[model samples]
Target: MAECNDLFLKFNDEIKLGSEKKKSLRKSRNAVGKDIQKYFDETLKVTKPKFWGQGSYMMNTIINPIEGEYDLDSGVYLMHLSDVEEEDWPATSTVHNWIKNAVKNRTSTPPQDKNTCIRVIYKDDYHVDLPIYIKNKDMEHPKLAHKSKGWIDSDPKELTKWFTDEVKEKSDQLKRIVRYFKAWKDFKANGDKFPSGMIFTILTANHYVEGYEENDDSAFVAVAKEIYDTLDENFSLDRPVFPKEELLEGWSETAKNNFLSKLSTLITNGQKALEEENKEEASKIWIKVFGDRLPKYTPPKEENRMDKGYALQTTEPPVLGNYGRSS
Candidate 1:
């Protein structure tokens, strides 16, 4: 029988970011950090322009993005912006535009003024989102600057910390499972079929049952079951870090159904994999669920017993003697 563990581990490696890319990403983010500091200190003359990483990178759930696209999110917390109100401590447009101008000339296209962040699109599959934030003394809490509504309470750092702590408390196994789910999200995001990364992350954390998963293969199986194991059709996901944060608040029903449909198919395939006698065949089933990144299934070599108590690998499945015909 082929080793299921080996297959999953190999698949995980194949789907994850490579060493060269990891180095490049780190370098790029470091340069970004410097750009933020330089623009604020010299150009804007603002003090203490600090930023922290959010999303998949901080959570260690980073995976290869679908197609040739990739993205990173960073929160820029500016402490000193002049002539701002107590209600609106940090001006959203001012900060967003500053970020926009900083990276505008650098990117292939002009920096976009998103709802909360200024997105810098790269030539290749790398883009970074710099969400403007404010930490006022009066508010005493980090508030994200929203273009439409002004300030809103959003702590990506808090969320990241919560996930990190949970992965620590339970096991690293959970984090790997999270990556697998994220990969599934990226894979199925052809159109409007897939849910947002935040939605999937919330659902996974909500439904994660720690002990059931021993490793990657079992973890995938466990998570597949856990998604459908819920009794309620209208399931609501709450952030583990911030219970008040509603993940699926305005998500469309069509999107939910699409996500669930894909997840259900994965679950059904996983069930079949568990029961199948041929290990190589089971891996093929998993490959269908995961996609082409998963390795092609190869059966174990048959060991042939010969003279002198020696063993040799046969080209085909080895045949054993001791045959009895019952008529």
Candidate 2:
């Protein structure tokens, strides 16, 4: 069997958000936060909002997209004023409009007022999602301002904590496994109609296999097979925290079937790559699953191979450095 650990590590490096992009994303996030803060302080003159970094960005499982723009999710929290009663919090649409109006002109494109959050687009091909919420002392959890669904109990902080805690308990490889699955989704689905990053994160965390920390190829195959078998048996996933609601309950039949079919293909190709002996051939199989961003396999020099007895020795496991936030 071919040891493709080096190739997997290289793929991870290529797909992850680099330092420059992270810096740019941070600057964008900070600017948006300030823009929102200014609106509330100078215009709304209501309760000031608190900002919390959430989603894949905070959990550090986000990958650089293959085709579309990047995303950053920030939670905007509005504390209930002392004079206001718990039952008298602003309407969901009102709060969403407040956010929308706040960042209206921050970008050349007007802020998009969506059902769940307000989206601010930038010229750099990335956007920030500000999910508004109301926090009252009497309420157990913050309520999200959904345009259609109205105010609903939701807390992104809980979800972030859940993922970070799982990473702490499990191996850090779980994070990479999630990113690999996300990259597959981005490359194959090619749009937002597929399973979300949160869904992928939940599935990978639940099905991640231990003891393959040194071999990401084996680790990914094991996790993919586990998820495939489980979803095949019962097509459902629940949020690990908060509402604890079904994550895939809203997926259309076509979307679910398409995901399953693609996942099945990934498993077959992944197993084939593992069985292939030629390093370059194995990498080609991987390219079919991921895109051409994966590094091409290079042949060892004849002199170095002879001096190092490479023909008789086994392939070395790739040394993977820490790729994301340690937490």
Candidate 3:
């Protein structure tokens, strides 16, 4: 089998968000958050809210988009109003409108009133999603101001904590694996409809294979196969914390089928790449999975491989220890 761990690592570096881009994203998030807080203090006359990062950005698995703008999910927690009664809580739409008004005129394009959050777009090819939440002092978890569903029980902080702990207890390679999966989703979707980053994170972490810490190629193949098989059988991913709601409940059948088809192709190509002995050929197979952004394979010097007339021996596949969850 080809030794393509170095290539995989290099590809990860290329796809992940750079330090400068991350800094810019952070600046935008902080600015929007401050603007929101100022609006509450001067206009709304309510208690100031708190801000914290969430989603892939906070989890350290965020990737630079293949086409569209980068995303940063910063949550606005209305903790100061914890003394309010649940019956007296503001309506979800009213809360969303408050957030929408808070960030108006901050940018050339106005903030968007999305279904679940208010989005503030920046000119530098990035946007920040501010999801509003209310945590009453009597409640155990915060509730999101969903447009259609009203205030629903949801706690993103708990989800982030779960992913962080999983990484610490398992392998850091799991982060890379999630990024690779997201990069593939971005390339294949090409600005079209696709699964959310949260879904990919959940599935990758749940089905992660911990044994291939050193070999990303085999690890990706194994995890892809597991996800494909498991989704094919059950086709459901529930939130790991708080609400424990089914994440895919809102997905249409067409969307689920589309994701599954793409995943099948990835698994097939990845397996072929692992089986191919020629490093250059295997890298080409990977290019089919990811895009050309992945580094090309360069053949070793002739002197390094051929000794007189003897052919080089191929390396065996790494032994996989156990799955993150039972198969």
Candidate 4:
């Protein structure tokens, strides 16, 4: 991992700049942009140059403005060598070797070190890996576009574009989401341990639910509803959850302390309430503890009501379960 101190210091600098931080981020993204450009320029001599991930910062979407570290991502375009036969469509390894050879032959100063093996380093920093076979040079359409649910499951290049575009177009909504996530992250960091990938999945799902479009009817609301329903089915107040130590790394200590404190309070109060058979007080305390972490929805009082006489009383547990797991 990079130096945590260095990362925090840089993060602090960017946060002090206010909106200027966005521009600084744009400039940082341009480094990857230039690298992609160089890949096209260098590889075009040997193989065709197809579409590159020209979209804005992929890492910026889910990033907390307060957090300084941001990973840069850009998909490199690739094409087959003209002389290479179609019979040798190229195995994954062969395609990787082709990238190695092309990077080795570059005239411009390489972004990566010369001795760095292509396949290993390429896959590590880029986040995802795939083989793109192109016979002709065209920098227009994405390398692959798969249609789904009214929109396209297109290349991640499009996803990157969508993320940046949404940040610009739905600035207020994006800000709200950012604020929510920032708070959610802090809240989760403080005591509530959730799945490691939950936040990223939620961030991505928000865009996906919004229907991969730039319009109002994007699928986000519906997706949120579905997630809400799922969670309603699976929540249980008796369970004890601790922050997964391995996932949070640096923050694990903080999370662990938070978890222990919260868990102790929960158990102590819970046992007292149970001894008194005050389910209502116990339930309310649990809700007070974790309700904000739940999905945004008006719960139907009837579903969780203890009895018909208790219909007017809001004693039931709020929505529960793995809301972020499905959809």
Which lDDT tens digits does candidate 1 get at residues 101-129? Answer: 67766656887898978877777778788
Candidate 1 ranges beyond 4 A from true positions: 1-3, 82-85, 88-90, 303-327
Query: How well is each residue in 192-255 modelled by candidate 3, as lDDT tens digits?
Result: 5666889889889999986677888888888888999998898888888888888777767887
**Clashes in model 1: which pairs?**
none
Question: After superposition on all CA atoms, what RMSD does each candidate show versus the true structure?
Answer: 5.9, 5.1, 4.8, 16.7
Best by TM-score: 2
Q: What's the TM-score of each model vs. the native? A: 0.86, 0.90, 0.89, 0.37
> Model 3 reaches what TM-score against the true structure?
0.89
**Which parts of model 3 have CA positions greater than 4 angstroms off?**
190-193, 250-254, 300-327
Tens digit of per-residue lDDT, candidate 4, span 1-327: 001112222322332223555565445444433444465568554444454432223434334332324333334445444344434444444444554454443223333321211321322223112223333233334222111211111345444554566556644344333333343344445436643323333343344344322321112223333434443353212111121123224445555456445434533433342232233443344234334332222334553445656654445443222112223
List runs of model 4 lying over 4 Å from the truth. 1-44, 47-60, 65-68, 79-88, 97-154, 157-171, 186-228, 232-327
Local error of candidate 1 at residue 263 (angstroms): 1.9
In candidate 3, residue 253 scores what lDDT?
A: 81
lDDT of 2 at 146: 90
What's the ranking of the predictions by TM-score, best on top?
A: 2, 3, 1, 4
CA lDDT, every model vs. true structure? 0.69, 0.84, 0.85, 0.36
What is the Cα-based lDDT of residue 80 in candidate 4? 42
